[model samples]
Target: MSTARWVLHLPAAATSAEGVDRLAQALRDSLRHVPALDFGELTISAEDDQSTRRRVWCDAPLGGDRRCALRTNHPDRCLDR
Candidate 1:
């Protein structure tokens, strides 16, 4: 008998949208034990999409703020009509 956990579900069609950002912020804040305890269980999951478009991937810096990297996937094959 183990305790149940909550998760967060995210839309797969997100492309640097505001909703995604709000969710991310809420998630980060939710990680705090005190704050998280205030809310009920939540699910955090990403949608399943076969078609992954070109998006800048950023790392959540421990010191705060996110930065985009130069390296990318399908960089040459992307950016065209």
Candidate 2:
């Protein structure tokens, strides 16, 4: 199966390294059900928004569009590990 490129916008409040770790872990825990694709090429950045200069950015590999929503919108489903 082919993989999809995904960029999940981390919470704006997440400015510290520890915050990034939590969000990354949350993302991993959320996608545990998908066993076909492996997540890699991960990156975290701070974009200079017009309003807010410092913003959290965390992105990784996703199986496809089907799994994107679960990680992006539904945090409740993600394991809080």
Candidate 3:
């Protein structure tokens, strides 16, 4: 069976990429209690250019159906959430 996913567009007042990332992290942290929310697959992109996306989490496989929990482009070893 295939799982369907949806994109949620949230307009933010952040003026830079770092600011937007910070906002995304905050949102994920605040909503972490929601089981349906996938915190490890968070991302952000320019409001006008949806074609270009940036990953917020590593989302790498860690064996036995587990995934990495570190931020994207991290320099250290992968970790589970």
Candidate 4:
């Protein structure tokens, strides 16, 4: 791994189907547990990409797109982790 920062290997389609507004809410909800210092630019995909799922990274998102719902929307994954 290139020592750049985090490595959040999300499923890519963490929160799909849900509207963008709901997704953004979800992302915010997830970030509550994380510290702001670990924050980094947020990124998302219209759908799950095989390549991205393999290389997970976690950079705190200040905020994200209001267009697509988060790709990786797992309820258990959020609160549990």
TM-scores for all candidates: the values are 0.26, 0.36, 0.77, 0.32
Give candidate 3 regions above 4 Å deviation. 1-7
C-alpha local distance difference test of each model:
0.38, 0.46, 0.83, 0.41
lDDT (Cα, tens digit) per residue for candidate 1, span 1-81: 999988544343455455554564464455646543322222223345435433323222324332322223334322211
Query: Judged by TM-score relative to the true structure, which candidate is superior, 1 or 4?
Result: 4
In candidate 2, which residue ranges exceed 4 Å CA deviation? 1-13, 35-38, 49-81
Question: Given candidate 2, what's the lDDT at residue 15?
Answer: 72
lDDT of 2 by residue, 1-81 (tens): 898877644444477757865776676568757764343333455544434332222222344443232233344543221
Q: Estimate, for each residue in 1-81, the C-alpha lDDT of model 3 and write its tens digit.
A: 999988766657688988988888888778979987887877678878978887989999999968987899899999987
Residue 74 lDDT (model 4): 31
- Choose the strongest candidate by lDDT: 3
Of the two candidates 2 and 4, the one with more favorable lDDT, higher being better, is 2
Clashes of each: 6, 0, 0, 16
Considering TM-score, which of the candidate structures 2 and 3 is the better prediction for this target?
A: 3
lDDT of 4 by residue, 1-81 (tens): 676766665433445534543554566667747764222244444564534522112332334422222234433322212
lDDT of 1: 0.38
What CA RMSD would candidate 1 show? 11.2
